[model samples]
Target: MSAPRMITVWGRANSVNVMKVLWLLDELAIPFERIEAGGEFGRTRDPDYAAMNPNATVPTLVMPHGYTLWESHAILRYLCRTQPGGNAFYPEAPEARADVERWMDWTLASLNDPMRIIFWALVRTPEAERDMAAVAKARDAAARLWSIVDAQLEGRPYLAGECSIADMAMGGFLHRWFSLPVERPELPNLAAWYARLKTRLPYATRVAVPLS
Candidate 1:
């Protein structure tokens, strides 16, 4: 198969899910166009976007040959595996690839699942519109989730042992956790891991945007 030439991403800039896909493109040095559609944009509900993705979510990818795809993490893995030298992130061996792929799956299935509420409540919600009680509850839940990932990071450089798509994908949410004004415990390991990620060019320029 030949290398994909043109790819397009659809989603808002601030969406963490969308941010992950965008960051992946940056990592692969893949050039693409992005059109804002979800959140305040309202195009997600339109028939055109819905036809592309029935779920009507952000970070949908339009492949070179017009194959449309959705789900943020899926898009990242596809780009990593399909693009030239996909092995760097996805790897060539099953154990190594699965090591990275499992965490990418975990991010969508586990880590990111709990973080949605806290992110929306803290960053997206307006001051007057905010619910302190719910935000606090979500914050506590999110902290526990971070602890799980932190535990996984005991001595490893990143999830699944390398800076794969999992790192870039989960890094989007982790960036929010560190940057937001919410109070959190002194998770030294997680903090250390984050310090290393923040130094990356993509994390510094894209994933490391202002929290609110």
Candidate 2:
């Protein structure tokens, strides 16, 4: 009999999408191998890496059986379906699962672009090279979007009423949004939620790293 192949994740550690997957794996205690790719590591454009992820994106997941999956959110859903102790975060019930999924989708659709703009402007660009106008625009956009999240989190400890993939999806940006050297509106609930996420070891270690 052949030895089993371990699941592999290809992405750089600083990627928020990659961090989400890693945090969940740790939360579920699933062991997997990680290979550095994307960003400064720069394997993403290579033909071999492109074959695995045609988008040449960070976080291409290769399952133990040799199945390949791309897109971070899809990988998160697949892991929740296949791994033990996953249903707790991604629930089996249709409506309940949708609730969790809604925020994940929302994070990608509404929150991602503005946050990316803000991060690249403030973190990646040097102070002299910074585009303060663009940064201010993105900052305002992010604040408006985050206000919706703040309202949703008013009576809930986590999005979707429990610590789900929704939180994991948005968690990394929470770290960045708060950590960035920019003024922010007082969203008390969002602040509190961020504090809650900080208490989790997996979140702190995986998602809350210094912005690169």
Candidate 3:
């Protein structure tokens, strides 16, 4: 029998969190229906969506066995395991895989703060309503963070040098960092890496869409 299919993802398309899952699904070549939720749509807090996901967050995954999954990164990891060739996205080794996981974790743990403010100011919030102060702070902080990534890409093609999940996970946020309205100093290495990631199908179809 074929693998069961009852997968549905709930989230708005413009969300970075939602984009991560979409890009992963695209890379895995899994077909899924996405219903609009969260952000401006505001269905995330409804009892129906809440019942499936208590956190009321976008990008909830309804599995074939009727299991519900929440949190964006968790969904990425789950899909990486469930799909065929999943190990390609998230490997099953000790050294290289772990290193990839580290950068993916860093995107959520560290990059989120900086990316959020920058994203909101440039994409979500209108020009007059934007908080220039917060945007500036986030831009500076994110640039500092990018400097670390710049150093990491000294001779690598991708993070961990193989286009693993770390690149996609972090790529979603870095899209905004490069596109947002801010003065960024010339960091050729980071810029070049971002350019290379743009060539991926997932990055082009999902992550590289107009922010917001």
Best by TM-score: 2
Scored by CA lDDT, what does every candidate get? 0.81, 0.92, 0.84
Off by over 4 Å in 3: 1-5
Residue 82's C-alpha lDDT in candidate 2? 93
Q: What lDDT does model 2 reach?
A: 0.92
Stretches > 4 Å off in candidate 2: 1-4
Poorest 10 consecutive residues by lDDT, candidate 2? 1-10
Tens-place lDDT digits, model 3, residues 1-212: 12237578889888888888888888888888888998779988887788888887778888877888898878888888888877888878889878988998899889899888888778778789988999888888988999999999999998887777888788887788788778997888999988998888888888888866
- Superior candidate under lDDT, 1 versus 2: 2
lDDT, candidate 2, 32-147, per-residue tens: 98999998999999988888888989899998777898989999999999999999899888999999999999999999999999999888888899888988899999999999
TM-score of 2: 0.96
Badly placed stretches (over 4 Å) of model 1 are: 1-5
TM-score of each: 0.91, 0.96, 0.93
lDDT of 1 by residue, 72-161 (tens): 877877887788755677777878887787777877777765577778777778879988887788788888888888898998988878
Better of 2 and 3 by lDDT: 2
State the lDDT at 182 in candidate 3.
85
TM-score of 1: 0.91
